[model samples]
Target: MAPVRIAVVGLGKIARDQHLPAIAANPAFTLVATVSREGDGVPGVPHFQSLDQLLERGPAIDAAALCTPPQVRHELAAMALARGTHLFLEKPPGATLAEVAALQGMAQASGATLFASWHSRFAAGVAPARSWLAGRRIDRVQITWREDVRVWHPGQAWIWEPGGLGVFDPGINALSIATHILPQRFFLKSAVLEFPANRAAPIAADMHFCDTHGAPIHMDLDWRQTGPQTWDIVVETDAGRLTLSNGGAVLALPDRTERDEDREYAGLYAHFAALIRSGQCDVDVTPLQLVADAFLCGRRREVEAFED
Candidate 1:
């Protein structure tokens, strides 16, 4: 089959670092065009200021990968679906759960493939870990996701804004892996969200969770770590212990260790390509819903004002 003609919207760091490379490496996709305000697209592709212009005047496109902020994702996704273009959304599919549900409906109505890509869930170690834990009872879960915003996000002001999601932005990636590999689903039992004295979002979070089977879980997310970063999850089962670190690229136990190169975005685009070819949609909202639940029930605590 011919390569699926594709366009990437929002030419920011992620688009440049991950999406563009992934699309180029995957023969299943052809990066036909790009949408960025500067018209500063990849060397050989045409660039448009808006999706409307691309859909109206450019050559036909089979799919679009949206790397825009979650706040505006729903509108762009709806527009693409309406035009019968398959959609690939970055993690945290939409700013709100309701918007994602609506986008799911729009994709269905238009028969367009809608893939809410969770790059972390596609990490190399995640799938094998899930398979290893099959039918095992989880006794407890511990998650520690701490990173320095200055190093990773730099001057991303939106991260502290009302809809930016702050620490949960990176924390959700952990949730994606946890939800994907765990034997049972869990829900928030209590949460303490630590917001910077002046910001609208949390810079740190402490949460406790439980599953119907009485299994307990706890997570700590902090955006103020000064030096080495950490993204790790540990789950203890009836038989042994399992741990995944480095955002799910590394898996370890007391006796064995395994590591893999980060091919998350590459895997994500491949999955999107398959979905487009098969005329299917994958819209798993469990991770996003967990974020939503934290926002809904979390108790707020004001802390030292953060400036960056």
Candidate 2:
């Protein structure tokens, strides 16, 4: 079968660092064009200032990976789905749950595959972790995801805006893995969101959740850590403790520990290709729903202003 002709909309850090490379490595996809408001694109592919320009004058594409910020994703996704172009949405899907749901409806009407891609759920250890926890009794879960925003998201002012998820942008990745691995469904109990004095979004958050079985789950997310970063989830089960570190790249169980190379993006693209070939849509909104709930029920606290 011929490779799926794909375009990448958004040439940001993630597009360059993960998306492009993954598409290149996957023989099932061919990069036909790229779109971004600023900065150069792939050396040889056609580049556009906006999705409108691409759709108007660029080569035909079978699919597009929307790497743009969540705030503006719904429009681009709707445009692509309208043209029957398969869509690969980066994490958080959209700024609002309703918009994403609307996009899903559009995809269904257009018969286009819409994949709300969650890279973290594709991490090497995530599948194994999910398999291990399927039959085990979950006692509790603790997630600590801390990183230096200055180091990771330098000069990204949009992240502090109303539609930008801020700390929850990264926190949602953890939730994606948690929701996938944990057997029972979970719901938020209470949350405390710490916003920087000068920013519209929170820089840190502490959340408490409970699974259907009454197991406690705690999450601590902060974007202010300076030194070595931390992304870990510890789950206490009846059999033993299960731990996933390095954002689900490493897993430790009672018998042994497993670590694997970073292949999250590659896995995502592979799944996208399969979905396109099979004529299906995968738009799980559980993680996004959890974040929305956190914002809805969270208590607000102001912290020192952050500058970057």
Candidate 3:
């Protein structure tokens, strides 16, 4: 079978760090081109100032991966699907649930695979952690995803924008993993958002959620932490404690034994390749739905200004 020809839209930090490397490593995908405004063209591949130009001039690419911000994902996704190409979208599929649903409809009608890739759900230890929790009763869960954005994101301007998602960007990853590992479907109970005084979006958020069966999950997200970085999710159950650290890369059981390394992006692309080959679609919006519910119900509080 021929490798799927892939073109990536939005050549930002994630596209550089995760998507490109994953595509390069995957035997089923070929990096054919990229769409970027500044045009840091990928070597031996074409670069376009926008998706419009890429679609107009590039070779026959089978799939288009959107690494752009959530706000604009809908239009790009719709365009690709209409052009008879499969799509791979970054997390937080679209700015609004309505848009994602619309894209799903269009994809089905067009017979194109629409994959909303939540990379964190593909973490190295996620599979094992999920299996461990399957038979046990989950009691409580706590998630903390705090990092110094200046160190990790640097001068990324879109992060603080209205539709850029701010701190929830990382927080959503935790939600995705939590949703995947938990046996029961959950709903939001309450939330509080801490918006930067001078910014349009929140810099921190604290959310509380519960399952229909009454399992409580608490989430804390901050972009201002400066010390040793922390990205962890701990679940305490009737059996024992299951801690997934380094953003689900390391899974440590209660007995102090740890397992595996990170393979988030690689796993996502592998899934994407398989979906495209098998004529299937994978779009899980539970995490993004939680985010939307929080935004809809939470009261906003203005906090200290953040500048990169």
Candidate 4:
């Protein structure tokens, strides 16, 4: 295989720390260009200010990996798909489910492979957990995904804006894992979104969910925790108690420990490569649908202004 020639757009923190490094490490991809407004072009690669400019001047590329915010992802994906370029979208697909659905239709029409990259679902432990939980009755599920925004996101301004996803930004990762491991379709029962007085989006959320069988599930998300970041999910089932922590990178079961280091982005790229090679488009919007459902049905409550 002539390593898929690729370009990366939105050279932000994730593109720099995760996407770039993963592309460098994977032999299946070759970084050929970049599109960014401010980022210094990746070494030895052509950099364009926009996708239009890149398509007009950059080298022939096989695909484009978009690491931009969800607010603009739909437009970006449409642009790439219109050009018959396979698209790799970073999590949350789009700000709204409707946008992602539209992109899916566009991809089908253009005959381009569209991949909604959910890095968390590729975590080392996720497959194991999914295998064990198969055909088992889930009694309950609890998710605690709390982290300090100051420590993790630093001073990103967009995170507090509408469509920036705020707490749901990280919480979606948990939902991706849940939707993958549990076979049943879960629906949002109720939710309380706690928004900071000064921001347009919520800083925290409490969501209650249940499956078709009425098995209860709850998730508590907070962006105010100042110490020892926590991202954990525990599930109780008739087979055994399984726990996945560190954002689905580790698994603990009653029989034995199944632990492995996470190279989530690398796994994601590998999967994307496979999808492209197989001429298949993988666009699972269930996780994003859950987020949309939360937004649609959630009751908003005002909280104290959050500050670093």
Candidate 5:
């Protein structure tokens, strides 16, 4: 099969650090063009100031990866899907569930592959953890995902905007893994979101959830951590304790441990290529749904203003 000609939209930090390298390494994909409103793009590849310009005048592409902020993803994704271009959406697929659903419908109508990618789910330990817990009786689950936003997001002002999702941006990664690994479906019970006095989005959240079989699930998410970052999940089951740390890159079972190099984005690109070839769409909104529930029932608390 020929390599899929692909364009990468949004020349942001993630696009530069993860997506570009993944595309370059995957023999199944060939870089064709790029789009960014700030006049940023790859050196040799065709660069467009907007997706409209890319579609109108840039090189033809079979697929596009949307790496822009969540607030503006819907319009960009819709344009590509309408043109029968396969799409790869970064985490927090859209600002809202309704928009993502609409895109899924568009993909179906156009016969284009729509992948709402959860990169964290592709972490090496995630698959193993899911397999190990499949048959065991889940007793309880705990998730702690804390990191310094200044380090990760830097001066990305869009993150604090209304549709940006604030800390849930990273928190949802944990949910993606949990939703995929757990044996039963889970729903949010209650939540408390802490908003910095000056920002439109919350800086931290404490949420409680429960699975169908009554297994209690607790989540603590914060963007204020300054020291070593933590992205860890601990689950207790009939067999024993299971731990997935380092953002699902390391797994610790009762008797053994497993760890591997990072390959989340690589795995995502591979899956996207497969979907495009098979004429299929992989749009799982479970993780995004969980984030929506957190905002719906969550009590809001105003805290000290955060300065970036």
Candidate 6:
């Protein structure tokens, strides 16, 4: 079978760091072209500055991975589906749940695959954690995600913008993994978003969540930690305590013995390849829904100003 001819839209930080390298290493995909504002050059692939230009030169491309911001991805996804190309959307599929639902409909109508990928769900220890947690009764959960924006984001200014998602950017990965490994789905019960006084989005958020059964889940997201960054999730269950740290890179039991995993992007590409081969679409919007709900129902509080 011919490899899935793929194009990547929004050649930004993610596309450069994770998607490009993964595609290059995977035998199931061929990186054909890219769409970005720069429109400069990328090795052997044709590059277009806009999605329209790339779509005009489409058809040879079997699918397009949208690495754009959540706010603008909906329109690009719709266009890709309308043109009969499959889509792979980066995390937090869209800025709104309605948009993702609409894209699902478009994909169905066109008989195309729409893969809303949450890379963290594919972490090496996730499957094991899920299996271990299934038979146990989860009592409570806590997540702490703090990072330095300067070191991680550099000059990326959109992250602090209204649609850019700020600290929830990394925070949502925790939500995704929780949604996958936990036995029940959850809804946000209450949330406090800390927006920099001068910015449109929250720089930090403390959220309270509960499942239909009332199991408690608490999340703390911060972008101001200067040293010893932390990404950890602790779940207390009937069987034992399960903790995944390092942004899902490491898993530990109560005794603290650790197990490591491959990078998440690699697993994500593997899942995409399997989906394409099986003629199926994998679309999950639970994580994105939590984000939209946070925006709709969250109490916004003004905090310190953020620079860049």
- Once all C-alphas are superposed, what RMSD does model 1 give against the true structure? 1.0
lDDT of 5 by residue, 47-115 (tens): 899999989988899999999999999999999999999999998899999999999999999999999
**How many clashes show up in model 5?**
0
| C-alpha RMSD values across all candidates | 1.0, 0.6, 1.2, 1.0, 0.7, 1.6
> For residues 44-101, could you state the per-residue lDDT of candidate 6 as single tens digits?
6888888898777654788999998887888899988998898899987887778888
lDDT value, candidate 5, whole model: 0.95
For residues 1-308, write the lDDT of model 1, one tens digit per residue. Answer: 99999999998889999999999999999999999886489887988899999999987899999998888778888889999999999988989888989999999999999999899998888998998888988899999999999988888887788768999999999999989998888999999999988899999999999976899999999999988899999999987999999999999865788899999998998889889888999999998899889999999999999988
lDDT of 3 by residue, 1-308 (tens): 99999999999888999899989999999999999888676988988898878888878889988999888788888889998899999988888888989999999999999999888888887888999999788899999999888888788777788777888888888999999998888898999999988888788999898987798999999999998988899999998999999898899987765667678888888898889888899988899889888889998999877778
Q: Which whole-number lDDT from 0 to 100 does residue 91 have in model 6?
A: 85
TM-score, model 6 to reference? 0.95
Candidate 2, residues 1-308: lDDT per residue as tens digits?
99999999999999999999999999999999999999878899999999989999999999999999899999899989999999999988999999999999999999999999999999989999999999899989999999999988999999999879999999999999999999999999999999999999999999999999999999999998989999999999999999999999999999999999999999999999999999999999999999999889999999998889
TM-score of each: 0.98, 0.99, 0.97, 0.98, 0.99, 0.95
Give the distance in Å from residue 67's predicted Cα in candidate 5 to where it truly belongs.
0.3
Report how far residue 267 has shifted in candidate 6, in Å: 1.4
Q: Could you tell me how far off, in angstroms, the CA of residue 46 lies in candidate 5 after the best superposition?
A: 0.9
User: Between prediction 2 and prediction 6, which has the larger lDDT?
Assistant: 2
Global fold similarity of model 1 (TM-score): 0.98
lDDT of 4 by residue, 1-308 (tens): 89999999999888999999999999999999999989678878899999888888879998999998888788778888999999999988888888888998998998889999899998989999999998999999999999988887888888888898899999999999999998798999999999999998889999999998889999999999977889999999998799999999889999987878778999999999999999889999998888888889999999999875
Higher-TM-score candidate among 1 and 5? 5
Clashes of each: 0, 0, 0, 0, 0, 0
